[model samples]
Target chain A: MKVTWSRRHVLETDDWSREEIEHVLDTANGMLEVLSRPIRRAPPLRGRTVILFFAEASTRTRVSFELAAKALSADVVNITATGSSVEKGESLLDTARTLEALGGDVLVIRHGSSGAPYFVAQRVGAAVINAGDGAHAHPTQGLLDAYTLRAKLGDLAGKRIVVVGDVLHSRVARSDINALVPLGARVTLSGPPTLLPAAWRCGDLPSGVGYEPDVDRALDGADGVIALRLQRERQEAGLLPSIREYARTWGLTEPRVATMRPGAPVMHPGPMNEGVEIDAAVAHGARSLIEEQVTNGVAVRMALLYLLIAGGEPRLIVGAEPPTSIAGGEPPATPLPTGVV
Target chain B: MTTFDRRALEAAGYLVVPGFIDLHVHLREPGFEDSETIASGARAALRGGFTTVCAMPNTEPAIDSPGLIAELVARAKAANAARVLPVATITRGRKGKELADLVELAAAGAVAFSDDGSPVDDARLFRSALEYARAADRPVLEHPQDLALSARGVMHEGRVSADLGLPGIPAAAEEAAIARDLALAKLSGARLHLQHVSTARSVELVRRAKADGLAVTCEVTPHHLALTDAWVAGDRTVAWEGRPSPRATPFDASTKVNPPLRTEGDVRALWDALADGTIDAIATDHAPHASVKKDVEYDLAAFGISGLETALPLLLGGVDAGWAALDTVIAALTTGPARVLGIDVPDDDWTVVDRAATWIVTAAGLASKGKNTPLLGRELRGRVVMSVVGGDVRYEGDLRAAPLAVR
Candidate 1:
């Protein structure tokens, strides 16, 4: 189906319509086929440049974006704040402009400040993909999680999806709620009062979402679960009494999983604290989709690079004149193999 | 009156009133000249229809000594744009630990004492400062905030901050500090003036203090009177009383300010306070910062709005919408602030305003170097055509040209 995608940047899922989100999921299906192939190379973004500007430390998201760009044959450069000009007090806009001046076509930015990518996207012309700005939106993570859930549960409408732990500080939980509520999934956030503020219960939750401080009650009759990592800094800030108490009360455990509907899947955005937020047994268990989420992360990101750089209309890249310039002679045109059009 | 004077007065939408006096302004001079100098800030004051402005002492080298006060006064005289009054810091270096020499500062032409950027958090030290300031006969202007409650918050705590996932400064932060200061004022029998009072509960506290006959006064900023915390959402329609406009930019750092903008209910409470005489004056709190400070992430950006150039049109818009009486608004700007400083509004100083004149606010059009206003692109309804001070035409012409009488 030819859907008109007018958005040039992916900053947050708050403003995205259900159709736009479904379009990205549909495009990721084709990228999954491409990833499954032995060669795994694509020519859609052959001559484009993708810059990974990670001002914060990350292993999963950074690798996922780099591999996704490489698979599409785009040039990728990585910049971290440790030894770069950012450490010397250079501003985020200056760094983005330097990348833009060097011919970067798409800038993937991750910063410790919330709204850092939105700050850069307003100033630069390059397409910006937010790689988890501070406690703000992580649109691609939300997309991949949605993709994984749809693959397992068939349809998300009217499904009870419980998101557990440190929700006030987790960009993942925010994006998940933003992504799920529109697709008709009833999301309930559960955590301690310090981590899940009472404001979320008093008319602050988005339509079709609820707040439950008790994890057991939230998990009752849930179709799936997404457990967020509880950083130790919350304890340092006097939010939690101790990690052990948090685990004993709010953490997802074997008994907690048994309270859910039978065969309900469990997911976690990774680098989890094994005994803290989720037990190791539940993470590596049969119904866990944590590994599938990492794989789907690459696919979802590849689809984003393709749609944003290729202007959402696949015919423009497949058969019509290519939008971005090709360095070598024009590669032979090939129709997208997975019925993406 | 002369025939020419009468003719000009009879002209459509033109009104001549006493020149405005701003009790709070951060002429970021002795330090941070890249953002604004004393001379440039004075020029901005003249262009904004203010004949007299009290300079805040939060600059670098902290205006704590008589020599710094004399130097600031000298710089303002050299600029010769608007009358600038020096406000000395209550603490020796505005460190909130030790009190500065209030007797010497008051003797050196300091009209007020304040720790404008940081509140005097120490109760014992604050009590001593208030007692000393009373003897010196200068009102202790406080920037009311409990840092512990407002820790690391970038905007107001409410439904908006919850959705944006940013740290929030709850209304309790300001209310708690106000309650403390009012009790201190009652204990010491000293004059207390709060700067940039932002919350509804803060107004109620001040109103109660006034009814109890405590010497308490407070001022509200134009931004807080008109704009709400929703401005951080980048939607102008929700931010103020304006037409539904498209989002200029999302997560704009320009909307970031200290004691961040509160909800619409709070804004309404402020208007009610102003109408009923709970709010003593309308001070600009005209803090300016270089673009380098405001062009970063909203969290990393400095907390202020370059508000000197926009204060008049913003309030006049409120008056036009029947939110406040014109006489009350003008008095809050002119005679009201004059009474706060215990100074006389000079008879010769006047501002000529064209209420029907409309202009769009742009960065390049501003006299102040800081262009960090959330109203950057909106059309404002009034303009100051001329400003007069001490029988001299200090500023005349459209805002495009420099003032005519720079010393």
Candidate 2:
């Protein structure tokens, strides 16, 4: 009668709660302080050995985690999960056990199945952090996105944000769903009908997420914008006529970004398709946090590393609110939950 | 010279068998009139040649208290042609969480205690019931089912149901309960009587338990012994609607019973249990329901068919027709069940089974309150000429007038 769930086991946003979202965001603020310092790093994962297991091709995240580990002075092992003994029928469970046997402390996995990380983490007794999996989740990218927005807008509650582009195939969309919903911002998933799983209900997601098919409808109540990457690997064979046809219907140009709630930030999850996805003018535009997100990525990874390893001491807390301890153990803050003082 | 000693004449082609016993039957009372009543049903039982019957605890008010048991016993005494022994519920209700007043119920002449239609789910409560039964020196007739496993399920889960688009009720639901109950019995030292043991494997468990000296016994319904899932299908809309289905459909309001029917192999296995003494007895499970209530779809059908008048004839007819031997047949109906209930049956009962005497049974001519007679219009082989309850004639049949003897 009892079952447990962990990691990016689900394919959409509403998986993370608002309180949990805020906790991660609070942790992110601690990360920002680590950035402003001259040392740029500290021992977060001191005695821990972290293994970055990525079977998918990677770019920013792969480097960010390794550098994050190096900055924290933890031993690190990077292994591609494909074409190993696993292809010879080694279960995800057996491989995880083998890795744990080798003294691997944490498994940071990115794979092609939506719940692969969850499966691996559950099979062996290990703490798992999802990197990216099958158009499902990129938790680190989601943290960087929130860390960027929180830096500018102060607190995210009542903030307006719109995510654009081929969100239908972005693992970052799944992560953003978890991040944005609880950060106190409203989210609408806008994409073609074919991209939607029929069973998906906006309420069924974690706290603050929703789905919509119309871009104009999304822009109507928008705050900030997050444009996701198009994974050509996700396209059904011959389902789409051509790249031009996809661009005409679903692409996000600068003009589209201009229609958001005024002063709302624009963001992307990197490896952008240039003029085809979002016009070049907007990619390098002044209103964009695209570069700040990567810088925030290393900072967030450092923050995550510090909290996960050395456990950061609370510093001169800034515009950020206190950690919302909704962890069943804490007493309700106001005799009941209300906005943080 | 002898105008013919009908009772003694009845003793020849067959043995002067004592009245057969049925440990389960539902004489739906307190309100449901269209279905059945103790009066007409007992008359049917008399005609069926059962000298004694054990009434189920599931009724209008439910037989959970001494007052309800007394009420049913009163109605049964006034109505019965046979001795009626009603099993009282083991809880203030058959809710199964709390133990009922076992000592009080046993004092009120309850043949046994059971929560039959519903299984007691909570393990601690069931163990408590078993302990209570042990202390009271009575038996707990368990309705074998783990509700969670058998949720919203209808037919036995197998190939037939898959093809018919029927929901599967896995054998595990029943077997799981049986296994747990036997273990509980082992711990409590109480006797356990398994109700409607349909599968061969279930009989094997009881046999093993008996060999190991655990006080365990089981009963199989006539329907489970005789019907199968093939009855669920039909040729060109019921050309193969099955021999039991048509007659059952009329009174079928009461035709639906739980542990719904198993497969053909299970039926054969039940017969095998009868032959090998694996099954201790045959119970009509004579669940009666009104005709109006049966008009619903098979999925929602009430579970009974009139068996008061059919139990003896069916088993005896089945024997005469080569479906079973009379020795195996009589043992299931008489001493096999009597011993399960701890009754000391005398030796000279079967001398009254007159095989030559004919039975004129037809649904058109029955007096049962249930209109859903599954055997209507089918001519079965044997009939009870009369019942001798306590050395007295409780029932007698009219002689068939011959052309010359008509004068």
Best by TM-score: 1
lDDT of 2 at A4: 15
Candidate 2 TM-score for chain A:
0.79
Can you write out model 1's per-residue Cα lDDT over A132-207, one digit (the tens) per residue? Answer: 9888778899999999998899789999999999988889988998888777788989998888643585657778
Candidate with top DockQ is 1
Output candidate 2 Cα RMSD: 25.7
Q: Please give each candidate's TM-score.
A: 0.94, 0.51
Regions of model 1 farther than 4 Å from truth: A313-341, B1-7, B10-13, B238-242, B399-407
Docking class of 2: incorrect
The interface root-mean-square deviation of each model, in the order shown, is 1.4, 20.2
Model 2 C-alpha lDDT per residue in residues A155-196, reported as the tens digit of each score: 888876776655544668767766765777777766665454
Q: Scoring each candidate complex against the real one, what DockQ results?
A: 0.62, 0.01
Model 1 chain A: ten consecutive residues of lowest lDDT: A332-341
**How accurate locally is residue A271 in candidate 1, as Cα lDDT from 0 to 100?**
91
